[model samples]
Target chain A: MINVENLTKTFGAKRAVDGISFSVERGEVLGFLGPNGAGKSTTMRMITGFLPPSGGRISVGGHDVVDQPIAVKRLIGYLPENAPAYTDMTVNGFLSFSAEIRGLRGDAKKKAVSRAVEMCFLERVLHQSVETLSKGYRHRTCFAQSILHDPDVLILDEPTDGLDPNQKHEVRQLIRRMGEKKAIIFSTHILEEVDAVCSRAIIIDRGRIVANGTPLELRRKSEYAGAITLSVRGVSASAVTQKLSQLSSAKRTSVIAENGSKVTVTVFPKPNMDGELTRAVIDATQVWQVEELRTEEGRMDEVFRSITMPDTAKSPESRVQSPQS
Target chain B: MNSWANIKTIAKRELVAYFASPLAYVFIVIFLLLCGFFTFSVKPNLFDRGQASLSGTFFFWHPWFYMFLVPAVGMRLWAEERRVGTLELLLTMPITAWQAIVGKFLASWLFLGLALALTFPVVWTVNYLGTPDNGVIFASYIGSWLMAGAYLAISCMTSAMTRTQVVSFIISVVVCLFLILAGFQPVVDFISGFAGPKVVDFVTSFSVVTHFEGFQKGVLDSRDVLFFLSVIAFSLFTTGVILRSHRAG
Candidate 1:
């Protein structure tokens, strides 16, 4: 439902979004993962027609964002980063106004507002002034306004930013449910959120997409699969290391730490031998009490850091030669 | 049909917002009190004028009065949206820029008209005492409404330039002051000597007071009506350009 080609947004001397191209299909949820100032919100703004892109083209539901802005905007619902709302307006009043701007009126306007209120769980505070509500409620109110028109595409920037744990869970559930019927591109720094709600993930860093894949696919490519940590008792450290190295699958093994009779070993497996090496370690250390032996599953934080921050030790040419995919 | 719905929605919200706060009441009260005070205390005896026309007292100060009052009303039209960040939401709607602009202008203009209508007591008093020129009174009301629209357009443009209400108000007042002073006798005298009489007359013809004076005399010249309409149209068009640039930038 949305296509962005070579999109770049520049703010004076600074390039906020640089040559990013991605498309989202209907009923697909794409999580935009990035750190602060990573051009996520800028991309969202350009797609929503709130800010013009310095270069490239964006189209929503086949309408060019620049040439056919009114049509494109009609098909998309955008919740800006900060959830800026009219503080003086009541909750129902704001939603009703939004519905009207979307061309709904009379019974249609009323039904749209009522549906938005129910979806965002805003019925309880429908009559309260928005300025008087808590941040979570205010955020929900913004969500209500954006979807009031039932647009085909939803561009939400940090939709669950300030909510408490329970509120976050509720909002995430709502997002997941909405994603089943609409095209969604939600930007967030929360990695676990991507795991929870997004079917596909696009990781952006320093104004560029560094990685794009499913969560399981990303985990498979991570370096965490190469290493294993083991805790053992009743075996001499040198003997355990030697036995571990003797296995054809084991690339290297060394004792990380030793205290009393317990030993912690860090093991690196040879290529194409992750599971084999773990099994060999368990078999070789049968004489010792195996307290813990498992391959480390990399945390999303590590994947984020590794992608964003290239290892300085690697020469520039070598890094450039290495294929990302 | 969609455009009409969009305009109605925006107008309704704007008018409701005006009434929800103390803004509408405050503006009306201050407007009525100031106009009444100037009409009775500041002017020389109304009886001595003997013309039974408000041209000397009530209608004379409208240009200056509106120079400040209209800005006070229009300064928040777009500036508040920027300050609160609702401009993005407004722009993201399906409505076009012209729809939003015209919708807001109409709402604020209607509010100003209501405020002007509250001064009927002044008209009633004048009619009760002497043989007032009903034609002049009618024309004066029309003039005041047109002038209010002109001032409102200028204020809307200024408000679009800045997010701060104070800055919007100050800038609008300054611009409106220039437009009002362009036609005064002293300014015209100063300019006539340097630039030729034709240039002075052209500049004077563009002033708010210059066109409004004809209405005070109960003479609805087509030129005067066209001048006010042109000013309103020009200012609103400029406002549209500025807002479009803002959205693009």
Candidate 2:
């Protein structure tokens, strides 16, 4: 378990992480989503006790980070951004060193290293120097080190940054399996990863928490949540748009595109009226030549973009300098 | 005592890492070559002096050799860690700042002692040539090791203050040069002109060269031992402060 209260980190005139608070319960995988320079890494560093907070408090496993940093660190298994590691060391050597520092010895240390190696799929390259391994292997090696001690809390910054799709999937599965007992928090710019791995998600921007919810909940916030697209043949663009606008469940309607006699219309439904709207569209199209009709489950990418870049959404260029200045 | 485990974990890793790179070999070879060159081939050569003592020829080259070689070791101790981003991993471990500082300093000190040990051939050769005072040789080796620890402590502190190894090396050399030259006769005379005798004595007491003089003369004085140890302690303490501050940054 991890509790962070009003944590803040400032670098001179820049507030890297403004007052923010979040808790991660055991068995929960909290996905930290944010853009570059959005304080995700800074938050991770503060929680790990690697960087001191300018204000507020962080306690891991009931130990105050500032007062009991060593104890707090003992409870944490952190993988720093870029997975920085001693490149000269072999995979086994680095893991053994990590295990030793984590207070394991003899048979326990050997067992921990081998278990981590197996979990991270690092067995094949265990004897090869990290510098000679490919980027994905190096990343996995660092991942293996973080989990070597099996700490109660795991804080990873971009855990799957440079991995291939299969490696990424494997890592996600690994995180999912580990999430059964660990309070895991990982920051990533990859949106789809949150859906795949995180039980809960927190979106941050410009040193602030912009949104927090489940993946489906975040998707529901998108404007396309109850919207539908209709492609009709043998109808004028304006005619189809008018017919869709007249429906009782339709909140708004607009023509998407026109190709000769075929037209595509986007219909926005009133709150909690997607079912009625779909049925209404089907009835209205019975008389017309209906080429295709589809319902949207909502766009999470659009939701994320809008939530994190609201200033850029309305005024695009004018708010480009808002976050920093 | 578990803290000892932490220290050993760090020190052993550091020592292994040192020997894993070409830097260790290059440094040892250069150290042996220089020590041998100064003892046998240079002026005041061991054979030319016709004296059984190595104090003038052997111990004389140490402070000078350590001035550069010690920094080469200490420069990477913290600066390289900071540069490569391993400092984050290291300091975030259960170990405290003092442990990491002491652990790294001890690793470099031990490596320096190993290099110093390789010159045992000089000891044997001198013994074969004449009846040399073994006590003086023994005391001088200890003194040289303590002095190397002092130099390494200063270098470690300097390295902790910066992320650039080159900058760490240059600044450490400059500081060690001051510590080495502070008690020289010319420097003492120059300082005595503007300060009182008590102040001059205090300044001389800070000199590595002055404290080391007692050991080269075969005297295992507690004052010299205390001075070298105090210098090492003070520098290592400063290194802890720098590391802590950097972590806070």
Candidate 3:
């Protein structure tokens, strides 16, 4: 439903978005991943027809963004970064105004506004001015405005940046529901959100597309893929390490944690030898009193950092070892 | 046309926004106070003149009042939108740049017209005192509105070029000062010394004050109306160009 071809945006001597191309199909949610100044917002702006690209073309719903901008805009529901909205107007008033500008009139306009208000849970604050709403409520109000017209494409830049944890989950669920039909493109620095909601992901760095794939595909690129972690009690750390070293096909073994009589070890399997590594760890578990044994699918953050960071700046120690991490 | 619908939508929203803020009330109160003070308390008071016409008291102060008040009403047209980041949301909508520009200008122009209309008591007072020439008063009112539109057009255009309302107001005041001074006798004489009388006449013709003079004498000259409309059109055209360039950059 949306296509961007070799899009480039230059500001004086700096290229904010270099030649990058990506297309989003119907019912696909593309998660845009990047750090600060990664040109994520800039790319979304170009696709939404807010900022003109220096070179290349963007088409939403088969309409050219530059040549048929009004047509393209009519089909897009865009939530700008920071959720900027008119503060002086009431919540109901603002959404109705947005609906009117989107070409909704009379009964259609009233229905759209009410439906958006319901979707965003803005009924309580509908009569209240936007300036008086809390940060989360303000963000929701802007989000509601984007979907007011029920457009075919949704291009949101950080849809849950300032929301609390519960609000973020609700918004993610809302996006997931919307993604079942519309073409959705949302940007975020939060890696877990990609795993939760995106069917496909694109990671950009310094105005370039560094990695693009499904969530599972990107995770598989990590070094920890198919690695097994063993935490055993009543087993000497050195003994476990010595026994694991004797096993063949094991790429590397590292001590992740050691506490008195308990030790946690991670055994990495050589490429395409995950079976051998699993067998080896299980055999060792039979010999020792194993407290925990789990396979490491991979960490998205580690994969993201490895792909975007320079070789010399790699920080393997920064990986979170918690269960969800 | 669809564009006209877009314009009306934007203008209605802008007008509502104006009334929602305390600034609009503050501006109206100060405008009414200043108009009453200038007409009744200042020199050449309407009662003291003993003339049946409102030209000396009412229309005389409009050019001076609008030089400052019109910019105050118009400086927030685009500058506030840009400063608060709503400009991004507004321009990204289905409307074109020209529609947004014209819609905002008209909204502010209409607000200024409303403020001007509130001073109708001055007209009522004139009629009660004597049999005044209603034609001249009506023509002067039309001229005042057109001239205010011209001032608002320039102010709105300047507001689009900057994100600071104060900077927009200052630049508009400076430009408006040059427009008013072009017709003032002392400034025209100073320029005539270096240039020629023809140059002075051209400058005088361009001044808003000179065209407004024809209306004060009950003359609805097409040339004067055309001049004001042309100024409004030129400013709006330049505003559209600036906004397009902004998107390009």
A242, model 1: CA deviation in Å? 6.6
Top TM-score model: 3
Report, to 2 decimal places, the DockQ of model 3: 0.83
* Clash statistics: count for each candidate: 0, 0, 0
Error of 3 at B126 (Å): 1.7
Error of 1 at A109 (Å): 2.5
- Model 3: per-residue lDDT, tens digit, A257-308? 8898899988777887888889877976797889899999988988888888
Which TM-score value belongs to model 1? 0.93
Per-residue lDDT over B190-227 for candidate 2, one digit per residue giving the tens place of the 0 to 100 score? 99999999999999988988888899999999999999
Q: Top model by lDDT, which number?
A: 3
- 1 or 2, which is superior by lDDT? 2
Please estimate how well model 1 matches the true structure, expressed as its whole-model Cα lDDT.
0.86
User: Which sections of candidate 1 miss by over 4 Å?
Assistant: A235-260, A265-273, A311-325
Tally clashing residue pairs in candidate 3: 0
Fnat for each model: 0.82, 0.73, 0.84
Can you list the residue pairs that collide in candidate 2?
A: none
